[model samples]
Target: MINRIKSGIPGLDEFIQGGFPLPSVLLVLGEPGTGKTTFGMQSIFYAAKRGEKAIYMTGIAEPVFMIKKFMSSYKFFDESFIENGRVQFWDLGTSIQTMGPKKALDAITDIVRETKVTRVIIDPLPLAQLFSSPVDYRRYLYDFLAALRNLNVFTIIVGEKADESAADLEAYMVDAVIILYLKSLDNPLVYKNLMRIRKMRGTNHTRDVLSVEITENGMSVLKLD
Candidate 1:
């Protein structure tokens, strides 16, 4: 069998038997300050090392410079990566502000066509959903995924969870769903981070609730407690 495209995300790749299948939409869900954006950025940087063209698309208010600053702290985010045309950034904040998800999708499609991106990340999709209904958001997501699949690109969509309902539309639309949770432990009086591979279509993924942490270098997957 052909080895899957490994994301090189420490333990994550091993959990998926390799990594996400090519041309699949992987949902990375979490609450605020849980490192979802960092994880997605690191994934794009990892892809760039393999000579893949990557696009970091965001729906948040964060400026590209700020994203690059965080990414630059990691060894994988090298200047040559951008200089050599391996990585790019696209901010959808303004587009989502002016147009809706449908139009925003058109803008995204135009970027993909112009860049031949092999890996793409969409940070904090809730903003895009604000521009449209849940049903319309899901439809646009499906259409976007179909377009990405046609282009043979692996896509990562980030979502912030206000509640379980935050994942309803995405869980039904994407090829894979990864949920990150933060729990308080009374004994230690500390908050513990956890991640679950809620689902991954067409692959035997690890169902264990694993721990995660962010460092000056970047996010790392820790062992399940």
Candidate 2:
């Protein structure tokens, strides 16, 4: 039987047969305001609360202070986990910029193994692609995923939704692909946010476009049908 890792998002587990497959890499694609960061952070915080260690790594150079400030608004955000070392937040931007992809990968592997983290989030992974050519980027992803899988941790890679199709290297390389969309309604003045499980290997999952809401407490997925 394949093991599963709970995502910690309310109403999400039901769609994916209790949760994501264990030791799998998931690609989360979404537009700027579609709650990708919240999704990743919430999952980390949830696992941390349950006595599991997790890490949040951002490919961008944004300060951790700014991230905490924004996350503070969410009810699920817990500063204590960070303070107590149950959850770690690392910025990989400098490593990628200064040492390049090879060193950056080494840094990530070292950290995860040293910390014994069971869950990981690499937010805005598209930034890593900017540092390498398309061919090199694909190679980096292949190596990165293999390294993470070797650690037996559930990983989430967040990226902006590109104009490219699902066949895009990033989407195709991961074990699962989830797409979040913010679409304009008929009124034109309003928009509706939805999430879809584009592909999930080795597990049964709902493929329907489900409604998404970001409350003060965090995000919740509701089956539209």
Candidate 3:
């Protein structure tokens, strides 16, 4: 049987047929306001609840306190998870901007080395482009992914669809790719939240895009009939 890391997201698990494979990278691509950050938080929360250590690493607007605050509103997030030390958060925004790619890589290396991070979420990795050129960003991602492999951490690199090139670069670099799309249909009542498994290395993934939604509670997926 193939070992799968349960994501703990309702409908999503069924679509992936379990969860993400262990020790692999998954790219979560979406447009702005498409629940990309929320999806990452939920992934980390699920891992932490399952007695696995999870690390939330962000290169964008998400800060430590803010993430915690928003997550707290969700039933899955609580003080015990924090006090018991199942979850950790790191913001690379300032470090990446000030120290540059090499130093930023060092910072990332230090965290993975120090923490027992079974699941890692790097929110909006495209932000790395702001600190370095496209070529340099690609180089940094390659080296970073290599280091993650050595550490054996399952990682999620979140990206916004602001630039098509950035998304293509990330898809080429990661072990798996998941794209979230919001579509508005012609009918007034027609709308949809869809997720497609673009690629997952060494495993067969579903081709049809699955429907998903984000209500006041959190995200949910609906397996296609």
Candidate 4:
């Protein structure tokens, strides 16, 4: 039996066959304002609550302070975890800009090894693309992911949507791909949040788009026929 790492997102685990496979990297693709950060942070916090060490690393997303500020309203946002060091946040934006992708990867590997983190979140991972060509970025990702796998941690990489016609290298590399979108109905005024599990290796997961809601607590996947 494959070990699984529960997502901790309400009603989402059921769809992914109890959660993601252990030590697997998952790609969370969505546009801005689609709650991508929220999903990542919530998962880290949830793991921390279970006495597991977790880290949240931001690429080009908002700073750690702003992320905490925004998540403060959520029920799952616990300050105690941060205070006790069960959960930590780091910004890789400066490293990626100043030291470059290779150095950034080294920094991440060092932190994860030093902290012995079992879960990690890299928000807005696509920001690395700005610092390198497509080929370079892919090579960097391959190396970075290999390092993480050796550490044996579950990782979530949050990124923006890729063109449908093009192959998303990140998605292809990861073990699972979850896409989030905000869409309007016929009226164009009634908007809804939706989530889809496009790919999940080694698991029989649902492939349909499901309605979702971002509430005071966190995101919840709705049950739809």
Candidate 5:
């Protein structure tokens, strides 16, 4: 039997063999407005509430204060968790820009080791443009995830929606891949948020496009079929 970590997203566990497996790397791909960051943060807070050390790192333009300002609207954003030191938020944009890729990755590794974090999130993982070459990025992604696995931590890497070609690499390289989609409906007031699981290692995950709901309470699945 394998130990699993709860995703913190309601109605998501039943499909992914209870939850995410320990020491696994999960890649989440979605469009700009799809809520990938929300999913990651919700999971981290969930794990933190259960006494696990969690870390959320953003390697993009968004500031931590801004993330908190927007996230404060969600029920999953708990003040006590941050106050008590169960979860830590970090910005790797500057590190990646100034110190370069190797040192940026090293900073992450060092923090995780020092804090003994169990759950990790790197929002908008700089894959293509950040690296000088596609080959280098691919190698870095593989080795980075492998290192996290060896440390026995569950990691979630969020990124923008990738094409079919890029998606193939994402599926092959990560232990699991989740794609979040936002479809426009006829009415301007309403839209549909759907979730699709591209691949999940060692688990028979659903292939159907699952209906999802993103509310003040955070994200949840509406219908399995």
Candidate 6:
């Protein structure tokens, strides 16, 4: 009996057997302009709207205010949802810079436990920058995910889809891998935004590429008609 956490992405849950499985970490890979942040934020905010405690943490070099301003333009960006503090945001770049990877990892797990957050989003997780060596990075990733599982939270780790193979460490480490692409569409296809689930450990998921849309309303997985 796997408890599923609803992502609130229309047409998406049906593809993944109701929703994302609980107590799992999902890696979302995407290139620039692929709406990775939008997808992560949309899911987190949607969960918050449904009375779930959610937090968005940026490991990248983005400022919180600027992110808020950009996300504010979205229709689902609710001040009410954010005001209750049930939905929160954090900048982990500062922590990584000051505390280094190990302490920063501890800080992350500490707050998540303290806040009792059920949903978490880590945007642009650059493992290379997080550690000095590949061995250290792999160890950190393993520990990071182990902590997440122990905490029993559903997490989404958003990252750049630079030239990488199926041998990518984080991709192999997570429970699922979802990739978003900014593709060109013509008569052969009707939409540009595309999505695919490369792997889902516990459920039967679609291998077929799906179409998506990102507007002021937020990201939505379009139904294949």
- What TM-score fits each model? 0.89, 0.94, 0.88, 0.93, 0.92, 0.94
- In candidate 4, stretches whose alpha carbon ends up further than 4 angstroms from where it belongs are 127-132, 162-166
Colliding pairs, model 6? none
On the 0 to 100 scale, the lDDT of residue 87 in model 1 is 84
Model 6: lDDT equals 0.85
lDDT of 6 at 42: 88
Tens-digit per-residue lDDT, 53-89, candidate 3: 8888877567778877877887767677778778887
Scanning candidate 3 in windows of ten residues, the lowest lDDT window is 160-169
Q: For candidate 1, which ten residues in a row score worst on lDDT?
A: 125-134
Considering TM-score, which of the candidate structures 3 and 6 is the better prediction for this target? 6
Question: Cα deviation of 86 in candidate 2 (Å)?
Answer: 0.7
> Where's the lowest-lDDT run of ten residues in candidate 6?
159-168
Per residue, candidate 4 scores C-alpha lDDT tens digits across 115-160 of 9999999887744456448887788789888899889899998877
Question: lDDT of each structure?
Answer: 0.78, 0.86, 0.77, 0.85, 0.84, 0.85
Candidate 3: regions farther than 4 A off: 127-133, 162-167
Relative to the true structure, candidate 1 reaches a TM of 0.89
Question: How accurate locally is residue 115 in candidate 6, as Cα lDDT from 0 to 100?
Answer: 94
Q: Give the best candidate by lDDT.
A: 2
Clashes of 4: 0
lDDT value, residue 46 of candidate 4: 92
